[model samples]
Target: MASVKVMRMKLGSEGLDVSAQGLGCMSLTPYYDQPKPEPDRIALIHVAADLGVTYLDTSDIYDNHTNEMLIGKALKGGVRQKVEVATKFGVSFENGREVQGDPAYVRAACEASLKRLDIDCIDLYYQHRIDPRVPIEVTMGELKKLIEEGKIKYIGLCEASASTIRKAHAVHPITAVQLEWSLWARDGEAEIIPTCRELGIGIVAYSPLGRGFLSAGSKFSENPYEDYSVLSLPRFQPENSPDLVTAFKRVSRITQAKGCTPLQLALAWVHHQGNDVCLIPGTTQIENLIENIGALSVKLTPEEMVKLESIASADNVKCSRYISSRATGESSCTPPPSSWKAALKRIFFYG
Candidate 1:
């Protein structure tokens, strides 16, 4: 058997070492809408770590804390010391639907996560979603305290704007900023990448495979009932939309022509974005996890990079990534004019 591959990067001035590619644990526990059994989820995580995946991501709200507990179980027996465990707090579910984040709530949330994970300190603790109700500084202040208390070794923010990132960095050195960045979602490249570079903060990209669309498998289609898939996005909708299918096909054609899987192409693209950028595409299957980790070896030549850029630009991607309203709630880009055509996208993400 091939040895597990290791991908590593440094977080800003802190110089904390992290994986070049990580695992997102949310899907393992069914944070999206459904639930995967704890045994299966824990087994999958152990397989990732056994395969040399060092960076693992989870959030407090996932399966209402089940994800963390699952990870804690898997990390016992010294497995925790062998890898980096990154988890997020903040963004609570109210009425079983809405997510709320407040500064006070953030402080309390971190403590709750620490207890559940059963760790002396978190390798990296992130603010899962920006709480618009509180200033970025106030929210960051709570994180800074955690770091001071040795509860967290590093701080990160997910799905935050460049401006918010700047404010948070001023409060304390932000080691990494997690964002959704894939071939299908390029909004973060515009301003977010530049900001991270300027501040010396590392970029940790989630959904680097376009949530499996870029992989060498079935295309993303909708089930009016299966809310968790890409089809729920306004852009993926077959109506009132620009030609997303055409673009996806174009991506397929380009990657196929390159003699590589779309997932490999997409991951290579993310890796090429910058030296400080890292990717964390999650998968439950051991084969898929191994395949994604193999992306570290798929280097793209300068000419090939140009080819991909040209094809993607020519495709003129259309549609909103998340539900139109939530899309605006936490991004730098403007939603499409027809965003109102869709309702809150329901992705049946059960881990």
Candidate 2:
């Protein structure tokens, strides 16, 4: 197969240039299923970098830091110079999963990520989840300090509300806002997307393929419970499985006419979102990664975009994206600094 040349885009008005299509490294871990061997995963990363898919995204919480360690090993021997590494902090699993954004925690997390990635500085550092107990301002304050100390080049936030994004951007220019945006996940479009555009902040779209549902379709329903990790999601539950199957069939029909796989069409839909938007579609297989990169070649007319939107509109997709009470979205808003201590107490006692 011929290597697809990836185009570049600026993440924000701050002038951080990265490949428009990035590699989400979560799947390289065991989040979806048992991870592939270390050699295979590392080779996938090298292939991604070689193909110009250089915006590699990972997080500290992914498989308890193993994902970052894997990336570190892959970037050895000067491969680091060819890619832009983006990893996130917050959302600790130390004691049954907690979201932390305290200034102290933020500083410590940045230091730990720096050490684990074996890099002097991270290209783009993001807070994986908003800490409702801590003010967005407080989190951004510490992240800004990291930038000054040369620990991270740019700042980003994931699953943050429009209000929280605006407040955080005030502390320092937020280069990107990472969110779950896909054909089925259009909740961000109603508010968060406009907010990012209004502030000139680029969007780093995670789970752009709807957690692989748009790709695998009804096949996920088969032995869904075999993988307890995904079974916990409402979208994959027995009650909603039929709806997902129906939706995928509709999307598959369009792909047939376009002469592309459902995965390519799904990713192409995201690619058509805008130049300011970058989508990270994760895959462990080399073929899938190549197919994802091939999305750049699949073009859609305006009418086709509208047709696809109607098929997987948020209303059409039943069940919430996640079952976690802490699942953040465009509506996620943090409390003020004055109530930070009180919120922490509630979380400790109730949760």
Candidate 3:
């Protein structure tokens, strides 16, 4: 394998520079499944840092905080300074519900993440999801306080709508907006992504490979509880799986011709978006990590980019527990939520 030299990306004009690509560390610990042995996972992080992949992403809600701890353990042996650690707060997966953006909890969550991470100051901290019930200004206010206290170096938001990203940027210069952007998921492009670009904020695309659908030589499973499962996301339900296959075929034609995997093409497309765009693809195996790093080498032609973009829309990901439970003999996927405010409250607060 050749030495990987990744480009650098600036998170807007905020001066938060990260590797042009990142390693999403969520899969190394849990949530994706039972993690690989601790030493193996730690070795993967070391390898990634050695390969010039520095931007690391995690969230407090991932695997009950074990994800951050794993990174903390890996970075202890003089590897901490080599990587930029970015973790998220504001959403509690405790007992499966609770969107916490209250000022007090924000403070508490930051403290907890810092402790678990064993790091003095986080390179980037993000609000996992906005609590629509709470005003964006209020949450931004808390984040601003953390910055002033020198607990976090940069601030970001995830899964935020375009209007919400703009409003949040008003309170503080959001270094980046973390959202899922891949050939299969282009919701951000319609509004959220452009909003970030317009404001000069950077975009950190998570799940850049379309939740494993674009990965080469890897079997994808649609069941969340099964082995190979990637589900837990409403997008991977049975009804949506076929379209994922079709989308894969569309991209494979180009990858196969280029001697690259669909995953590499998907990642290169994200990079081709602009210097402001970065991708964080997660995996538990070192081979896949190297494969992800190899994506940086696959430069696409203008025609290739156009082809990928033309077939990028792989059906909208819209399914609710309400719809699923209502399905008697067969299941149906609906269009993206038109007015999800009410449904949002029901989901985060009730269920």
- Best-first order by lDDT: 2, 3, 1
Q: Write the per-residue lDDT of candidate 1 for residues 32-117, one digit (tens) a residue.
A: 44655667777777877777778898888777787788888888888897789889876666656344456567777878888888
Question: Over the stretch 185-297, how does candidate 3's per-residue lDDT look in tens digits?
Answer: 67678788889989999899987876666784135523323453344435555566666556666777888899988788888898888989889988888888888888888
- Model 1 error, position 135 (Å): 1.5
Provide the lowest-lDDT 10-residue window in model 3.
Answer: 318-327
Q: List per-prediction Cα lDDT, in the order shown.
A: 0.73, 0.83, 0.78
Best by lDDT: 2
Candidate 2 Cα errors over 4 Å, as ranges: 95-97, 221-229, 324-351
| TM-score of candidate 1 on Cα atoms, chains taken together | 0.86
Candidate 2 local lDDT, residue 27: 79
Error of 3 at 206 (Å): 0.5
* Model 1 spans with C-alpha error above 4 angstroms: 1-4, 31-37, 95-103, 221-228, 240-242, 325-351
lDDT of 2: 0.83
CA RMSD per model (angstroms) = 4.2, 6.2, 5.3
Best by TM-score: 2
Q: Encode model 2's per-residue lDDT on 46-128: one tens digit a residue.
A: 98998999999998878778889999999999899999999998887666648899998899898998889999999999988
